[model samples]
Target: MTLDNQHWERISAYLSGDLSQDERNAFESWLQDSDSNRLLFQEARLVWESSRIKLRVKNPATEEELLKLRARIKSQQPAGRIIPLFRNSALLKIAASLTLVTVAAYFYWTLRDTETVIASGDQVLTLYLPDSSRVWLNTNSTLSYTEDFTKENRTVTLKGEAYFQVKRDTAHTFEVVTPATTAVVLGTSFNVNDADSATIVTVAEGKVRFAERDAAREKDVVLTPREQATFHHRKKTMDRSRSRDMKFAAWRRYKNVQYEKEVKNSGLYLATQYTWRKNQINQSVIEGTIRNSASLAVYRDIVLYVTYSQPGGPQKTSRLVIGETVNPGQTIDYRRRLLDIFTETNVLHVKVESAEVETGDHY
Candidate 1:
């Protein structure tokens, strides 16, 4: 029997024991009318079971094996086949059918078809975690997670600043990976800022272990609360600092643009803010954006320099370091002034780091 919406619904209701006595009798009679209906019902249940096998990784089965089983279903060449009548005799089959339904319901409710938010300067975002760990994203940063995040392991890769207040789950430890550092927490609270390779992990509650990425590009090291770990991605060096930002701990309360914290770039490849007040960098107040249009504001005579080991060789190293912010669109003799500044200050590859704010001069 070809199953339509109504037929599927009837089959589902009968399997779930939702059908009335009269409806159940009718379904049983209908079930006997066509062996095709019975075959289809079993086929659908098996499909549900196969999808859930991934969640129960303890049991292993390949798609090819399942497909072979599906092919064999056509062999209704009934030899030893028997449909038990007594309800007690069908207990195991009923349990398997209910499990398929339960898993299908869970997949429908839990898997969110979305992407992670990675904000930059003065930006805010919301993140939905697999274990129901909700994160309030701050600005000048990026956050990303795959839909299949928990299939193998509970992990989310990130770049450029955001704070996390994790939900505890002992079965799987949540790991935050940055280019320079790794913050591993099972159920604690912390802030992980990875802006242009200047990675900082500050723990507020419980504990977290901070470490560098392994040669296989996996997380290493661990950390505890009231401690802050800093690392430079390119330099491959670890730096430790005293915890100053106490607010980095809180979760519910958030930041609204007062334009505080003049964060030092600290050889930060991307622009960032740092304060020496020995104050706290709360997990609640972080923000920023990646500037695609604003690579640099035209300042001086843009001297294009390239290192050539030989003729027509691919240029090797480049640098652009700006002393401070300048008025936008101001023309500069990059040749006479900018190159001289590069020679004297050793800061070259400079770009305009500006932000667009609606109704304010915050950026």
Candidate 2:
């Protein structure tokens, strides 16, 4: 009932297009009275402006954006082009009904004392939890847990994909909950992929038990090193297979082997850069060659081939990028020195006398 912490929530709701006309009037009045109200709206704009939250949308976006879209409608009202946006019967019904659900959930989650949602966006995110366990989230994936995660059973939710090199704790089993099933491991490294209805749990070291729970059906499967268990939800069955766990999950190590992929309109190799800034990238430059169809397979090994102009040793790379795709995001590591053909020291480069790779797989 009071306008304290809830003030920010109201502003957020308004920015998200969840507030009704009457509620919008109330918010405007509140904003007029308090300077902080305007400031708070500015902060919420950051979240509303982000592109990450768009992926969760069930329908295509017809409006420009939350605040910006609504602003456009107001500015273009005289032209009627923007008035139709607010008058759109379909969008009004959808926004009014759906706003309560999403905004409420977002507000509650943000107010919670614990729990966090970590995502890499277009880059790979590295996390060192309180328990000393290391988690590498692939591009376009999410890893979330309560702030007191390790205190409990080490439970976490996985969306998209990630590779884990968990610290061994037999007393506290690490549980990964995907959309389909749960994968439990003692202390080991593994790769988990969520492909719609099925969850793929691949174990590289130690052992893991995957539990599939449903009202009418329940099953459990134990996987050893170099093994995988795929849990299908709709059919309520699990399929198990063997894989080279270490080799398969090597992407977690920030390894990459760039090769020849046919050039298209954008034929140049793109050099990757990163920044800690919230609104924009601090730096970006063209650093490497873009491969074309002439090149075949890239690196299958987990090793790294990096170069640097400075006199620094090979102890650490300024940037860290992965060679494989665990999900949809594409990330380039910082200070990534590639042993590329462009780089004179690359051993993989094929010279005129060098044997040609008849088959791409041979590389």
Candidate 3:
């Protein structure tokens, strides 16, 4: 399970949510190929989280400098003998300093570490902990665990917002540390939000012990499913109440409902023309016209579901994003070019999946 530079690059891309659907599927298949692959990926992920360094080098060594370094390395070897670049650590380091290869080497060297995971920008990250616990981090959130993680203790510090599903380990208690509050449980699923002026803990399943981070155990409030506890930041006080609704977890549920509504209401028709150029690298070109039939709605960021298959083979679907705006009763034309399409592929199907409607102020 010794990963090469290319594997490391793919792992990095997967972590950053930069891989396309096809690449993601391939990487996931590779990950499931063996347990060692999964472990190596997890180790690299830890390093990635701990370093928090952008893989890009600000100032890279020039070509002449790289050549000189290589020449020096060759001079140290015996006559008529050459060492592989990967076999020599010194050469690897020298080359890493010169190019993007540094990212792979850096992670490889420190693969045994990190205790923090952050979900930045609009990325929502799902993490599988060492103890097999699950955590879903919302945007702009941070979660850090102790070095002993699942060994001697199961504790994690959280900032911003995160949802946790702790595995049942009767011998050890799971704990989540927020700025003002601490949530302790043997096994439970809960949401913790520390981003606002008050820290909020909402229990979705099982039970949790909620208290001030530094308060005595006597002050702890026991919360069951559908219960919530709020710790005020300024007043340093705690409030417990029964949750009548699931507003606390709305952030996790809103996206699906919104997307489904958009897809259901989208009144866009798609007509496609396919062309295969056998002489030019097996290029496949699809020209499509999208017509908006809605009378009052304007759409943008249209997502198209495309199905293609080789003759007598199973169909495969992929998504294409079109950012062009189409007004009510308007038609827009788009062309997509794909290279190296299978020579036997003769079927192409396209349809609008979803689109963002412009409602001016509100929808």
Candidate 4:
């Protein structure tokens, strides 16, 4: 196989680990084009290793001494005996010059094809993709994609964390490729975080396909709006759950709010009543009442946590949410039957999560 100066330069930079993210991806694509390409890279790398030593000025001598050494070596060769090209010191100097040129050209060429944005402080950088997608790079994060992103596909390689507002393109899929996972979507908004050993993907709008990569178990998880999935590297598993924190990506606006705990005795009022069912001693009924005390209407979430001590074993706890909305001064009554014979009647805890302020008119 034959390679021009540009290809040789790229191989050299790749061997040196100097290629940018986009350039590395492009070089990998080139390497996969054919078997001959791989062989060429291997051969070029070997040649590079051997030639680097020759390129160095191990022993510096004055111009007169160098000329004397060159002429003396030429005279020692047998008459009519052909000397190889590299044995000639002048040819070696030319080859070293070409090597230096290749290194310089590689840096210049890679800079032209890739664009990088880095957020090094307590601020975010807004970037526009070739397809018009918007990205907010978090502090100490980086986002690198092709300068001509929309030509074939829209792909961005991220390090650290970033929130993306991708433009919709049904023809081309928008992809965020990280070290641990790859998220693919047509057009959506999401936040991706590389958490050392795992990758967390939170979907804010639309749907996304979160696929695990560079892990033991390959899995594909679909995340809907207000959903999150964490890909764990050690376990090689993907865990999906409802995302309670909506302001996870709000750091870009500096408006993130971590909820505060309300006083345990305020806001929600709980009452419980028990009854025996059909004169059966083992079965009983427990009636519960929850009242909203706030004057303004709010959405209330209630969790009934029950703890029971298993015989000769450890204690266990289970919780069930009372999914309902209550208006101001409204009361909702619920009935809970104690069907479990082993559950202690008095070992229960009622927890009321803070009520969210209702939006829209209450009328």
Candidate 5:
């Protein structure tokens, strides 16, 4: 039986689990119609398995072997033996081996040209590049680098806003390419915002060479710390100015503070001081202060795990959420009433479970 594009698509969908139950049943019934159909399906499964193999390291010498195999297969293929299912078992093995080699060659070619992509949606994301450089991607941002990154090149393409702390490499300068402009630096921390109609570069440390995408070297501006540059897409013009405030990179600092708080929150940076008592109505009343000890971090949305025990019974844990903010070395007090607790219930422990860093985006 000869297979068309639709048959190939059906076979692929069946293997990938994309067919519905009814469609799957019909396809299986069709597969049972003839011996040739079963043989073809088996060959297709072997090809699918070959495609799933992960080829991490490519050997350059395999190109010659692949070429020789292709030539051998081509010489053996005749119009009369196009399907080859009825052929001898030895020829069938050769055909399967050729399929595997073809898939391997395709993977090698694709991996050589593949790019590493990192994107963020509603929340911020932090990533480390192959060169050990750190990047904080803001909401709706995308960053991609080629496979040759940190080896033959140290360049990245950006689509929204991101803060980059590029590693110092004197020999290879790091470059950030946007639609309107490009920023190059040896080692620096900077923010790049590529919006709808323009691209902005704000330097926090070191120096950045900001220029139009297709501009001359002389037209590029070297911006030092606290300097900003803008490139307008419509007019294709570039401008430079000094920024008094460093709020352009506030997102990076906010994310870093949150990360530090999470890393040091286990009885080190955040602590709870509280007192609990039984009210007149026999309800549990808890009042306390959540203190942030970090010198530069602010925390909010504190969630406390309250563990209580009944008279001669097992302990039960309840969650309490405090919609408050605690600054560095500052304490925020909160009061919560537990109405479901029994009159004789005792408060055993109250500990800070988690808290979110106060991130106010100024950009």
Candidate 6:
């Protein structure tokens, strides 16, 4: 595709890692939309890097060839005879100008598309797009975009959950793509969570155009602030309602504003200590006791994800249910054996996953 100057600037920003989360995600979505965009991005990157490669160390064979060229030049000319080519400085300047123009045109044509992918594994990540828009990706989430982002339309593909604070761009509309739904807006802040059970879209600020992802006969609705919509995958239905609780986007807000508070009061922090012992069969056994620190009883299953890492070696992470229906102030024990041949586990990152508050009575 023939891209304009705007596309070039976007690609430049992407290469410099200056794209915001929304822009980055949008650009990657454009990239996935076509293989040609991807190939163009790759070629542009190679060309951009090739310019720097010129400054690197030269091959010995190249130096030898240069010496041979110099020797041939010296032998071809008569003694004390000035070269005709060097005598015409005007011709030399014209040749230099033509060469510069050729290289610039080549780059302008080749480097028009770019792609970016961001993944938040255990912790949340905040990023800015080329247009200075901001987006925050939740844990275990991914976002992607392409160079054409914001140039024509601001679009993004998201997996899992994300909180977006898009910059105002009246000329172009911002859109978020998920497997279940597509959210369209113009400079608005919203929260999108696409989980196995359902895809939830909550408008924290401004309005959002939420639509189903069906190719044929798509359905859409406008969601106002404090309103949330749920697209149930199993039911193949979309439900919209005014949120009963004001914390419709509490999960995203918690990660952004009260992460430290959540960490301090969470169940993982309530585990006062841990014990590790080697069994008779040479397997390492890890043990820890977690307590329900929150006031609400945890009726749903709470899993503790632990990452085992050794110095200068690959890391392995595994999840196990620490407890189910842990009442307030109740404690539960966790024990697991390491089957890998790792001599010692040096680094351990423990966090709670899949935690839910029990609404009904849990005796």
RMSD of each: 20.7, 20.1, 21.8, 20.0, 19.6, 21.1
- Model 3: lDDT equals 0.65
Worst lDDT run of 10 residues, candidate 2, spans 346-355
Name the 10 consecutive residues with the lowest summed lDDT in model 3: 79-88
Ranking by lDDT: 5, 3, 6, 4, 2, 1
Query: How do the predictions measure up, each by TM-score?
Result: 0.36, 0.41, 0.41, 0.42, 0.45, 0.41
**Whole-model lDDT per candidate:** 0.47, 0.50, 0.65, 0.60, 0.70, 0.62
Error of 1 at 101 (Å): 37
Model 3 alpha-carbon drift over 4 Å, by segment: 1-114, 254-363
Q: Candidate 4 clashing pairs?
A: none
Q: Which has the greatest lDDT?
A: 5
lDDT of 1 by residue, 201-307 (tens): 88767878677753222344456667887888778877777786665533222342211111212121233321111113211111222122121221221212212
Candidate 4 contains a number of clashing pairs equal to 0
Model 5 alpha-carbon drift over 4 Å, by segment: 1-113, 253-363
* Poorest lDDT segment (10 consecutive residues) of candidate 6: 51-60
lDDT per residue for candidate 3 within 222-301, as digits (tens), equals: 99989988899888888999987655664642333333443468843333343433345565666778787552356788
C-alpha lDDT (0 to 100) for residue 86 of candidate 1 = 24
Error of 2 at 357 (Å): 20
Candidate 5 structure quality by residue, lDDT tens digits, 121-236: 77677788999988888888888876667775698888899988899999899999876678999999899999999899999889999998645579899999888888889988
Q: Model 2: per-residue lDDT, tens digit, 32-79? A: 554444444533542343222222323223332333433432342232
TM-score of 5: 0.45
